[model samples]
Target: FFGDYPREMREMLSSNLPKFTSEEKRLLQNKADFIGVNHYTAIYAKDCISSPCDIKTYEGNAMVQAVGERDGVAIGRPTAFHGYYDVPEGMELIVRYVNQRYKNTPVYITENG
Candidate 1:
């Protein structure tokens, strides 16, 4: 993994994000042997920063809304957990994203349901 925060995160959070010193960067760089992902389900993310939305707990403070449906159609089959959908493709997408983002670092599905 990179030593510092991602460029997109830094841009979004701006001064809200803490800076890392050269020593911290050196210590953090490529320190992880692998990435562990606990994937439960995939939900559509709607940007609330640019548009108005009814903020919910699932959305946290990221200003992004977690939506399970679009155009009156569900993203996937619903699970027992509210707002969670069983979307198999999400696993593939997440794994691919993590692999590419982390420079092809080894990844393990630590938890899934």
Candidate 2:
């Protein structure tokens, strides 16, 4: 992984994201041997910055809304948990995302259900 946060994230968060010092950047770069991921479900994300949304969700600070459904259709079969869903494709998508983002670091599925 790179030393600092992703460029797009920094741009989106602006001053909200902390600045990394030269030493910090050096220390943080490529620090992880492998990436551990816990994937359960995936849902739609709605940009809240340019649109009106109920910002009460956990991702409120990120200026995005986590949506379980779009156009009144559920993203996948619902689980007993309120927000979580049974989306098979989410696992593959998440793994690919981590691989691409972290430069193909060895990944372990630390926790999944």
Off-target runs (Cα >4 Å) in candidate 2 are 57-60
Q: Score candidate 1 by TM-score against the native.
A: 0.84
The CA-based lDDT of model 1 is what?
A: 0.85
lDDT by residue (1-113, candidate 2, tens digit) is 47888778888776777888999999998889899999888899988888888777453356788899998999999999999899998999999888888885799999887
**Residue 55 lDDT, candidate 2, scale 0-100:** 75
lDDT of 2 at 97: 86
Candidate 1 per-residue C-alpha lDDT over 59-113 given as tens digits, one digit per residue, 9 for 90 to 100: 2547688899987999999989888899999989999999888885789999988
In model 1, which regions exceed 4 Å deviation?
Answer: 56-61
**Each prediction's TM-score versus the true structure:** 0.84, 0.86
